[model samples]
Target chain A: MTDDIQSRLDSIAPLIVDGSPHAVALGLSLKALTPGRAVMGARYDESLIGDPDTGTLHGGVVTALLDHACGMAAFAGFGAKDTPATLDLRIDYLRPAKPGLDVTAEASCLKSHGLVAFVRATAHDGDPDDPVAIAQAAFMITKASKLAQERARRAYTEGRME
Target chain B: MSQVLIETLMSAPYVARFGVRLERKGNELTGVLPFADHLVGNPLIPALHGGAVGAFLEIVASASLLASQPLQRLPKPIDVAIDYLRPARAQDVYARAVVARSGRRVANVRVEAWQNRIDAPVATLHGHFLITPGQDDTAAD
Candidate 1:
């Protein structure tokens, strides 16, 4: 956490993601964090296996892992008070992750424009060169409901222009 | 789809963690995710974790595929594209998968997850899965 970035992030509140229950449930841990980047880790657990024949980690586990990591990056990038919400996410799976190996995901905010922040992430069990899956996502920088309410209130005050 | 396979999917380790239930009413099948405290992402808003909900939909998609074919191995997710239409409130969620097409090697599925109303979905997932269909020799053992 750099001073310039920390100063900006200070107002963001105790990161909306730290120690989240699903992350806790998945045993996801924050390995590293910077201004607009984050790395998370999750150890392979048999209980999370999706393919019994292959003993491969479930795709859902990878989805949650990558999603959280992406959110972390977006939150860190936005450095705002409100929580970031996923507007949409797209993941491309390259191959099945090796069983019994710990998985690590690295995510970074690609760009932030207006109310949306774009992020990308990759999950790899060992080598970064070969990723298990790749994720690209956009997250709303502010709580969506607040934005909707604000728009509605403005509409109410200004009268329905449309 | 075989009843035994359906039971197997519902009992799978990963799917079981979310307490996902699969039920069939005549020709229809549904997936349910019972609400639990651990599934909450933002305690401030108390919203359900997007990842949790996303994962639930993936399982539902997989289960739906399994119900239609006698695949030799569990289908592996190739990719998923999800759109969060609304914030998932804290409550039991229901999801159903519609198989757009099932090809020789791949299957396309569309999944919708909703809480209160079926038409108003919190999120929807579209994905392709690699299906390896064959006999389950292990079942004999």
Candidate 2:
């Protein structure tokens, strides 16, 4: 059941990128997925740099990726009918990422009940054992009817780009 | 090397007034927020506003970068997501930052904050900054 839902959500995942400028600017892309999991990939770019000496990526960018990844995972877990808003997120930073390395985030839905969902995710440069950061997020699901209307309105207002 | 960066950060009007200080031990940069009664956002709940903590984390991350690159101005915050682990008590706050990945264009940083208790963190920040090149400083702005 969840696997079927994940497949359907995967088809619409590209739609999530349509209206968010932050997603566009950060060069975030959705990669492959398993039944209850999703992976997001972002390359290191100049627009995301913090300091030249340390060559560290800023915390905000990581947060954005984590947030988006978690939200998408929740959407995938809940099927295509619901849109989720983040209620709260908690993160732990284990180590700083060395400069010029590709960063990847893998997120999973822990549980879903009624209109609430729980998710856990990790961000890392290469190794899962040595993750850069880990996060636990909670999301509140909206009604399917409302979400469909909102998506339609958003699509109409934003229109298609040439 | 970090002396000039520390001086510039401490000299900033907002930072100076807030009494933000930094000390480097090895590669780690630790930021200090001196205890001030006025810094407290709420007296009844006695909890610090999340925004205040966010701003402080931003400074720590920026200054840590400046310590290495003294010539560049502070990078603007593209966005910051903060997770409040616990209520910040009325005490000095300490933070440290690591540059996860620094490219020619953008930099990714992760920062953590704690009060007296090191075992428990008060908050964590994941930030993305848009790095401006040295030659195009004025033009980039």
Candidate 3:
């Protein structure tokens, strides 16, 4: 990838992450973004614990993180020009994340074609060797999403709203 | 008897954050996820986040297992495959889980989530969970 493309992706990555309300609710942050790849992090918080007794993070948290990470990878794989919708997602819980530890997901677009992309990602706390979960997902550029993107581009060009 | 168990299961910290609740009629359990601004993934389409919908399905699956039988602890998800049929609109979402098979050590569940009409499910989940049947006293419920 060229420097210009990398810089453009970097600038737009945070917009995608921050624009999502659920991502904000979960405190997800875009750590890095490159062609066909993205790294996202979620801060550890008490309210997100699934088991009060065990203090383990909920499996749903991992699901959401992986979903967002994989989506970002797919978006980048499309050169950050198109936003895709998830078709299906499969996740395997390898183990419980230790209490009081933040988690991160590293996702990469395995392949991309006309309108569909496949992505894989792994979630880990601090050690990449010990993954908490792994996810495989497929994303497609739907008609509704494409129209929405066009409208947003037009709005941006006209400076109607930031 | 099962209602009490369902309440306990829904009281989990993470599940409570999203304000998910289960309504019971006879032996059946229906899950409701009230719409919230924080649940939206695409403000452009203004649709509910796929993650929120997926997590809600998982919660309903576990709750169904708990309502079915007494368990030593909360069921742990082994693996889950979720198919998104439509973009979930920003509104209250409802779901019901059907236990396809419940073995001694593992349970297979299917979940359907919808917003307006039950026939039109926005997403579906097929998953397996690890469960431990209670010894005796726990089974009384």
Predict model 1's lDDT versus the native: 0.81
| Chain B vs. true chain B: TM-score per candidate | 0.91, 0.85, 0.92
Q: Give the TM-score of each candidate.
A: 0.87, 0.54, 0.95
Point out the higher-scoring one by DockQ: 2 or 3.
3
Model 1 docking tier (incorrect/acceptable/medium/high): acceptable
Q: How high is the TM-score of chain A in each model?
A: 0.80, 0.85, 0.93
The clash tally of candidate 1 reads 1
Which digits, one per residue and each the tens of the lDDT, describe model 1 over residues B15-134?
A: 788798888775577999999988877655567888898899998998898877677667778999999888898899999999999988999999999999999999999999998776
Which candidate order results from sorting by lDDT in descending order? 3, 1, 2
- Return the top candidate by lDDT: 3
Tell me the tens digit of each residue's lDDT in model 2 across A1-162: 766776666656665554344455556788855555778876786545444456666554566677777877876666655666565676665566667887888999898778878889999998978888888887765443245436554654686421
Q: Name the regions of candidate 2 deviating beyond 4 angstroms.
A: A142-149, A153-162, B1-141
User: Could you tell me the TM-score of chain B in model 3?
Assistant: 0.92
Runs off by more than 4 Å, candidate 1 = A7-18, A144-162, B135-141
DockQ of each: 0.42, 0.06, 0.80
Which portions of model 3 miss their true places by more than 4 Å? A1-4, A158-162, B1-5, B135-141
Q: After superposition, how far is residue A63 of candidate 3 from its true place, in Å?
A: 0.6
Model 1 Cα interface RMS deviation (Å): 4.3
